[model samples]
Target: MSVLADFERVDSDSGGAVLRFTGNLSLASLGDLPDRLDRVDGQVARIDLSQVARIDTVGAWVIHRFARDREAAVEGLQPASRHLFDQVVAAEHPIELPPKPESPFVHLLAEIGDAVFTAMHTLYGLLGFMGATVIAFWNVATHPRRFRFHATVHRFEVVGVSALGIIGLMSFLIGVVIAQQGAVQLRQFGAEVYTINLVGRITLRELGVLMTAIMVAGRSGSAFAAQIGTMKLTEEIDAMRTIGVSPMEALVVPRTIAVVTMLPLLGFYSALIGIIGGGLLCWVQLGIPPITFVQRIREVVPLDDLWVGLIKAPVFGAIIAIAGCFQGMQVEGDAEQVGRRTTTAVVQAIFLVIVLDAFFAVFFSQIGWI
Candidate 1:
């Protein structure tokens, strides 16, 4: 085949000239085509190959390079030529992206995995902590100023009590929505009374505790990380150590105690709000009185459901605190590190909570507890 046999340029109203082709393809034309195409610099330029009898790799490469480098568009590409263009686009190359661990849907799954791993790690860490606390027990025994009980109490109040209004309001809205959903199903079966059973069991056993833990993960877990992270960045942990104080005993202990103790109470509050909110729904949507709603709850909620919620509390609390502490302690001495740790704390905390919930689901289901 003869190279440059069809190498010819022509001008038109398509706004620019096209270097048209008809016969053979070769590397020599590939080399010169770019410079020739450059001649149409100030005009819209295209290379048309509709009639090219035979095209080789070298010729294709020259045309492709010329078009790309000069931003000259290519025209009349057949399926084969189009596929060649796609090959270059699909080449694996590095690109920048945000550090979000995963996208929205994948993030949900990642959080579940994090919750499970973080729960396991926290349980391991706590075992070690408990051992050390026991060894130091006798030394602090009978000391009047021991425990920093006042500060621990204050943190519980802060993390658990202060969050009630928002949790309560959201729970109420949730209950209303659930009741509305139930009314639709019950209307068909004529079992409207069962809405009470559904909401009661669902809220007390699962939604109550699960939702509360998530809230705490986002709210208190973030605060814990940011606070401790800032302290770490400012050398406060080092300062405590320099003064011969224990970071575990003084810092981690107080926060851990606060979160663990308060979670169960928060869980109870969440359930209460959710149920009462449901009760209000019964009144508004179902036309049942609040008294009847309470009566139904008193009938169905076994002590076991409350216990299920209670049992999960300390576990979730431990997960959130440990995740926060881990990320916080991992922070280096930088302002940006504080924000990074705070985000990690919230995300890891939420993740561990969901995983723990899944474990409870499986364990309770097998035991006929759910």
Candidate 2:
């Protein structure tokens, strides 16, 4: 049976109160003692635990806190109770927490700085990876037999041929939307015929290659990341290195070459499909015959627009491939890392593609291609 803890105050020789505790000083028996101790007052110079029976850590903590708060000495503790009291004293400590920002503005500035730092760090890593890839490409170039033709062809089917259906559907829909909107605006000016020029120029020069890059980044880029990330997690990449196989040449180079080669063909096909969609829309809505629409597109849209898209396509493909493979190479630790890297790869690829497209537009315009 547990005895309920109890204490009483008695005057000592120094005329200071001494709190003499009795009965069991344990977790089960000391329930109301803590609250009662908090209500204590007066000049308590010592705490007498000589009569305390069956003491535990709970009792030790309560007695130690009371003594410390009253600036009183603890006495009459048995050997076991003394050790427990010492332990409780040693364990008392304040927890440290992360410091808060001084103000909201400072917090915002800190976040912006972190973002900039991360961006710069990522850019530096990507540039180094690009350099390594170039060295790998050079090694393969010098030794043509080292090239993996079969792997490259397989990637071509995966990245390009498999992508055609969705790319075609998306491009066709975009073309129809462009033509429908262009016709609506042009009709107000009594120039619905010019909708052909709008659809042709925009799709061929900008939307066709741009949209294709975005889709490939989301589809094939994520796959590249997930595939290589899984390889990394399983130690297959390390095994390849151990066996004297170059991961860059065997894996990265094939993917890079495949995407770079296919993007231009895909872009051209997308542009053609988009133009056909616009022609159908024009025929159905604006009463313009398909033959006349085709003639107008051929007359108004320059061959330079097609060249601009083709030129941008390979660059976009290289960016997407490199970003995906680089993120995949970075994956480590766990399966969750694979998913995170895949998402990062897609986002990074699409962002780079759009940025490069803008620069291409400026360059092409400056060169009098627009």
Candidate 3:
């Protein structure tokens, strides 16, 4: 097709210049249009479209781009040509947008509001989950045969038995380090024998259960989220619901009970192992014999200290289980969501465990139990 188009300067005796459009001003006839437009570089005081026989949107756009900032007056446009020109002109000189500025205090307030809402929403979900779990337990209590015995046993093995070696080793190492450090410090006051008291009281009252809870939150809590999240992704939970199975009963209760049942036992075992490690360290490094260390521990460490750690264990276990299961239930069948929820479960479980531990400490101190 002939892409023929041209424009010319109409010399005017008046003060301003005029540009006259001639020939087919259409896309097909737009040859050298931009270059030709560039040639009309001087003042464009007027544009006369009356001589143009035909034009298209592209031609309209070319004219608009050329004349938009030139303050030129256009004349003799038919209705259709005027509409096209108006469209192109509006497009070329779009409305300018202004920026909105925010104060730093307002931004900080918005962030705080968002965080508070998120925390409240999480807490609400956890309460709902706890209620459902309680109902599931009630059902199992009445209909004993409906309990998932095999699943509970399996979880006990996974959450309890599988964790023993690492827990024991970590507790032992901690006890050894504390004893060694305590001996060095106490020797400054010629009271190195007090190392036994430090190891016994700290292990039985705080470190053993606290460390176990933290580890289990990272280990079993994440595992719970991953497992339940995978099941959620595969729609197994939905399928169970359709088949009249309560997911709380089938999935959540068994895991929760298993961990709750096993945590106190594990805490006791950890405390025992830690004390043994400390005793060994004392015997080897401080020249205090194992029997003497054991006697010292018994005399200095109250039975209440052991009870304090034991009491915290089951509560920590329940928090870990609920956090994991709650996050798992919230998963959206996405791989990224599964990973995110698993991480969230571990973090929330650990945070709650620590917070609960703190409250317990305060309560114990207030009641003179410390």
Candidate 4:
């Protein structure tokens, strides 16, 4: 049966048109309303629903949008329609919602405690994951064919492929920024030639690995959380245990190894690009030719600095991959929970990387490594 929609023209002024409707309103007929309204070709449009019969929230919502978009105030909507109209109006501009009241200090404290407990549960899960990872590493050697190839593949994909661009881009940009800043200081001291020493030292020992770790934490850590969290949500992790398969051996080991092996390579690549970027910027800043900058790098930066950077790169990678796999294995509840944990993994990984860098800085300083 075809349902009829009825309307009457209310009034027209030089500005626009107003249409009043009297009808049995339903969603089936209203789907075309918004498009029809858009074809209005009128500067101002007004819709009156006072005479509506059996109007629903959906119908009223559509009209409400039309009126709101025209900035026209609704008047004479049917009682039921008015209720629906009011709701749509409220939705359109929630300016009428009461301001949220602040919680008392005690209430805030209770919430924090609840949050802490939640964090502990997640950490408890991560501990289980770490245990599994240790066993998985053992399994890799014992059960060689079962996991070694898969682990290698995962490493190549997650660590090698996913992390390339971000590390390189950031490293290059850092090189440029460091060179610009270093040039200023060197210029003031009339030691412009030593800018190579500053750029090479900073990039090799700290910035390159540090930057790459941050990127991986964001990229790989989040990936781990997302993948594992999703597995948790789907009960795949539980299924593995049910089948006498270990989640750690099956999951975390491959990922951890991937990051551990690839991060150093990525960091090395980033450092080279960054050094070149720094050299370019230094050349411009120092008004020296590229050859001079290249010569200074060879003369000033000892090979030891390069080794220090390479060592730090793998440590940073370990931190990122561990944190990601740990946090991911910790997930509980829904998909949203998985996403949140993934974010936490990235943050914690970045924070730990920085802390580790500080430790390295102090240790390297003590050894006169730099």
Best by lDDT: 2
Each model's lDDT comes to 0.77, 0.94, 0.89, 0.78
TM-score of every prediction relative to native: 0.63, 0.83, 0.79, 0.66
Model 2 lDDT on a 0 to 1 scale: 0.94
Ranking by TM-score: 2, 3, 4, 1
lDDT of 2 by residue, 285-336 (tens): 9999988988898899999999999999999999999999999999999999
Write down the worst ten-residue block by lDDT for model 1.
135-144
Cα RMSD of all models vs. native, in order, equals: 14.6, 4.9, 7.1, 15.8
Question: What's each prediction's clash count?
Answer: 2, 0, 0, 2
**Candidate 1 segments exceeding 4 Å error:** 1-146
Q: Which structure is stronger by TM-score: 3 or 4?
A: 3
TM-score (C-alpha) between model 4 and the true structure: 0.66
lDDT of each residue in 141-256, candidate 1, tens digit only: 55535567777788888888899898888777877777788878998989999899888888888888888888888888888888888888788899998997766566666777
Identify the superior model by lDDT, candidate 2 or candidate 3.
2
lDDT of 3 by residue, 1-370 (tens): 4437777887677756888888777988888887878776678788888878778989888887777767788887888889888887776645768868789999999999999999999999999999998999999999998899999999999999999999999999999999999999999999999999999999999999999889888999999999999999999999999999989999999999988988898888888889989999999999999889888888989999988998889999999999999999999947899999999999999999999999999999998878
Candidate 2, residue 26: the lDDT equals 93
Off by over 4 Å in 4: 1-128
* Candidate 4 residue lDDT tens string, 1-370: 4354456565576556777766666776565666666776655556666666656767777666777678876677656667766776676644578867767987899999999998688667656766766777888779876685766796688678877777778888999998888888878889877778888878887788788888888877898888988999899999999998877777777778888888888888888888999988877767778898788888888888888888888778777877887878778877789878888998888887899889988998899986
Best by TM-score: 2
* Candidate order, lDDT descending: 2, 3, 4, 1
